[model samples]
Target: MKLTVTSSLLALALISSSADIGVHANTPFIIEKSPVDITLFVMSRCPDAIKCESTFSQVFQAEGLPEINPTLSYIGSIDETETSKTELDLSTTSTTTTTTVVTKVNCKHGPLECAGNTHQLCFREFFPDYKVWVPFVTTMNSWQPRRIGESAYAREVAERVLGLRQRRVRRFLSLEEEDAEEKKKELEVLLEKVDECSEGQRGFELLVKSVQNTLDHGVGTSCTVFIDNKKRCVVDGGVWRECPGGSTVADFVRSIKEAAGKVFRISW
Candidate 1:
């Protein structure tokens, strides 16, 4: 029978899943007990920044961490004539558009105002769920970095909060195949599919290799499933590492559970 996965179940699965690395009583990262202030610097048009804000907001709401006061900043236009430039050779028939946008314009205080504006819009677009600490403004040249430093501290707190949220999501979405008979059948089918796919001359071999590597080196440690500086998904040692490139969400969830099973030892 097909089981329905709910958000609550998913959250629970994330929380209850055993980590390959044994859980220690001590926290690795220090999160201040009090609320932290944060400033996020972003570009209005950068998708990476937008994703970061969205993910962070999800995590923030998931974990009831202390109240955070965050400021979002955007980098504005820049003068191309006054700045150094690099040229790239392109094929005449290339269809790709190579448009360069200058973020820093002729502002006296540099592009701080532009940066703040861009960041503000990005936060609004991506993290509408979270309460915005900074309102939309044309510029913020007088913005202080010390505020941003505090905001960074708040961001650290948000990470831990998100972990708790992830746990809830996992639990809410856990599959109910506890019986040995059912589990064995599922495993056999999965194995058969793997074998069948491997025998074909498809490009799935590389993916299989990556899964195998993750099984070997990914357990009991914080593995980054996807990371692009600003955006990342890290699976803690005890948690399952979701497949980085799964064809479907279900496949991705299965991969994470499988990886966790191989690496973790469950404890109360």
Candidate 2:
């Protein structure tokens, strides 16, 4: 279906059990997730993506954040040798839980996206406590599609404002710049991407393929909203065609809550 956005927001609070931030692929953790997949794939510079990210921020702000189970892994692997996690005290009241399984948390916007995705991965690996990754991603997503700056520019902005550490941003940038004999290898060292050896050689070719695998399902079209793989449609031209009965912008959120019921939140 053609995903179109008018003005409503699909707020998603992903309260991942924070992962260690500094783990590398060579020394990666044995990450495992449930069979469910409630992933969101968008170009790093798309305005639609911003709507989803920022709108979720508004939702989280209004309803509050979800508390991570701590035992379950959000970004990193749950098979780590050490047991280290920040404790989050949450008032168990409202929760909006979707079918979030082993979803790929990635970006499709080019070099800026690559860096953004990896930076988020690193944050989950190193600094998973703050959970401001959504804000940071949304900050970069605000960039216009036609006009975008260099990777260094994104890195500087993230560090100066988004609070990403200088070194971590540099590492992601370095990964984005890696190449060998007319082949880009930046995706190889991305700490977050799942390592897939498709079509031989692990490079941008493979990473792109991995990212596309999920996006092919049609979430890449616009700020596509999915609650547990069920597409939520916002009324366009007075037609609510995506769901059983769609609603307008004001009723959009209400429909989600009414449909999803009891959404749980988790910051960082």
Candidate 3:
């Protein structure tokens, strides 16, 4: 039997099937429903995204995943449009015609960012296990904003930076080309073969829409944390100058220190 994986569905259950996705394939990164749910929606290239990702790496490592369940994802998708063109040559006695595919893309930082965002989304949606997903995020963010173009460079980034092999990062940019339908099948197991990649689109869009779905935007910040429609915490402001409280990296660190001091006092 085949499983239909959806964000809503996956949040409810994790596919226990053995699938190799990350450097640490032994760890499971399943998203279990817990009292605390955190999602950080930001542009792929935004500095705030980096801050949020970095902060999560530090805090999660110190406090563990259970203390602060975080979902770091892009806030937009690549707009895909296809147009067919026929060109005729009437030079000789016989006429020859050719049809071509044209694709246009607009990403937050550029095409590189779109590619990076899609790869991250693919991992989160399909290959999310603690061993694979967590390491991928922490490592990729550490060396991210890579130069645009080529899956080979991405594979290199994975190997050298994340210590992942070739096949491990193969699907990272699997949905880059125009034929997303075919690529989705080759990339994700549960998806059906079709003319377009509805499943992939949904996965990408779900994260994109997460920004509007939460109170993060109200605070004018990228890595703001929200729980039950309430603003919890946020990294320093990125583009939005008015983003509240947090400003620089040190400000965030200071806030942590303050919180820890309060905890120490309470403990005493």
Candidate 4:
């Protein structure tokens, strides 16, 4: 018989199927090896989002934590009614074709916010590892409101965090210039990928997909966290709110550990 896993009922069903009720001391133990899945929904320029991510940054910084894989999603709306199009025509052949293009996406915080969202999506795409991308995002969020979508600001932040600027400054003074140059090249390549992604149509597509996921999940809040496919917490005004399961770093750590689930087998 096949069983569908949901809540604690799966545990009950497993226990009832065991043949050796109390005869065996060593029973087959099952343990979940999968990492916890966490999804964060946020608007790039929202203060609430900043606070929420800052809290999560602390969670990540905690020592001796379980494996937690977090994904970032954006929240916004797209206006399909308002669009721009490109027309391609061959005058001699009397053939014409038109293609509709997405000019802009409407964000609650306005165009700069939209741009910020796109850049973040691009960053996540290129740097999927939470360790690499999370701090970069947190730094961006900590920046002033005026710098939210500025490419210059983003470039400078990337340089500072990735140590590209320091590498450049040391290239002239260091004894091992070749090593420094190689390191600079690697960082520069990744930064170039981010720039290309954020400035192209692919960035818009990623932003739209992220927004759609937020809409599909019916998440209207600026900062909402989902763990193991369930709503875990919300942070607004720099405080935890709407967290039924508790809202401390320890609370989140406990949830993540429990979310690993359990597995066992009958020993007859």
TM-score of 4: 0.75
Sort by lDDT, best first: what order? 4, 3, 2, 1
lDDT of 2: 0.39
Question: Which candidate number maximizes TM-score?
Answer: 4
Writing each residue's lDDT as its tens digit, candidate 2 over 137-175 gives 555556533433344544444454432343343344343
Off by over 4 Å in 4: 1-32, 82-104, 168-177, 262-268
Worst 10 residues of 1 by lDDT: 133-142
- TM-score (C-alpha) between model 1 and the true structure: 0.23
TM-score of each: 0.23, 0.41, 0.46, 0.75
Worst 10 residues of 4 by lDDT: 259-268
Runs of candidate 1 with Cα error greater than 4 angstroms are 1-34, 76-268
Residue-level lDDT of model 3, residues 1-268, one tens digit each, is: 2355566577555443333334347655544333344466655566777767765556545432333345654554334455655555667556554555443334557666665655555555544544455565566666645542234444444344322343433345444445554543454342222112223565345444543343334544566654333455665654424335464545444444444333311110
Instruction: Decide which is better by lDDT, 2 or 3.
Output: 3
Q: How high is the CA lDDT of each candidate model?
A: 0.35, 0.39, 0.48, 0.79
Q: What's the true lDDT of residue 30 in model 2?
A: 50
Choose the strongest candidate by lDDT: 4
lDDT score of residue 239 within candidate 2: 33
Q: Measured by TM-score, how close is model 3 to the native structure? A: 0.46
